[model samples]
Target: MAPHTHIKSVHTLSPIDPWWKRNLVTYHPTPKKSRHIKVPWWSRKCAAALQAKRHAFAAWRKNPTPPLRQRFHYLEAQCKRVILDEKRLAWASFCASLSFSISVSQAWSFFRKMVHPQPPLTFQ
Candidate 1:
């Protein structure tokens, strides 16, 4: 013979609480702006030169010839020189725009920006 079982009554939940009031739901604030950004300083010409240098490097790797190797080295040096020259020119222009009455903090900030240009920033 099968055993008999008794049914138990269950209590219903009172009501559903708001999502914001739930314990598992967390509130995250939206990001309006970034605290810091990294800006690229590579100009179109500089970028093209660098790409050409990379291509030269790959070609030299396949052929391993004296001419190809020399060309690669030449392009590498030229690209580096161009990048540095652009940075120097930019810094010179920035310094030229500054007046003689600016605070030291401002000068330092400007110098930092010149060293590392950040995006979302407008240079004066």
Candidate 2:
């Protein structure tokens, strides 16, 4: 095996290059007039009133209604109980269905054996 030698070269960009001219020096047009326009007073007042109404509604919602909360909690608990009951019922139904299928298969095998009896052979 022989030893390998590697060489590297460095490249420099020129000032007169098209890339330098395009990137380093670019022209942008000045705005002829100001872009910002003043909002009308009526619109501002309406926006303020809408904001106030939203704040009032938010405050109203933040103060919890005790009766409503109690009712909601009660209903939620009932729903949980119902869901548990439904799961138990579903498991029972599944067990019943599995037992019924097993019984049906056994009954079918017995009926097939009874209907088709094998003949006996006698040798001389």
Candidate 3:
């Protein structure tokens, strides 16, 4: 058996080829054009309402109860419940916003496809 020799060479080029060509890979990222779609007024209103409710509950919890700390504990529990409900409402509003964005994107894509379509080609 003979000893194997390793060769290292580097080439410098004027203009570099695109990443896809150099790496021999193609990547198509999801289009972000949907961000242009405006969110619904109702969704914004609901989110605002939930935020306000959460803030109000927090304010209510700030006041100290009398010598009976048990009452304060109960109020704290109530505050926690209110906060949880607000979080739920906020989550629902967020989901609504996401759905609205998805629908808008679908509609836009359909419209684009209708306007300009790829032509079919035949090979000899």
Candidate 1: where are CA atoms >4 Å away?
Answer: 1-41, 100-124
Candidate 2: which stretches are off by over 4 Å? Answer: 1-63, 99-124
lDDT of each: 0.65, 0.42, 0.43
TM-score preference between candidates 1 and 2, better one? 1
Please give the lDDT score at residue 27 for candidate 1.
Answer: 51
TM-score of each: 0.52, 0.30, 0.28
Which pairs of residues clash in candidate 3, taking residues 3 or more apart in a chain or in different chains?
Answer: none
Instruction: Tell me the deviation in Å of residue 8 in model 2.
Output: 66
lDDT of 3 by residue, 1-124 (tens): 3322331211232234344334332353334653232322224334444455545556556754453355545655664465456446645664565654477776565445333322112110
What TM-score quantifies how close candidate 1 is to the native fold? 0.52
lDDT of 1 by residue, 39-120 (tens): 3344676667778888999999999999999999999999789777877876777678788888889778766765664323
Error (Å) of candidate 2 at residue 115 is 44
User: How many residue pairs clash (N, CA or C atoms closer than 3 angstroms) in each of the candidate models, in the order given?
Assistant: 0, 0, 0
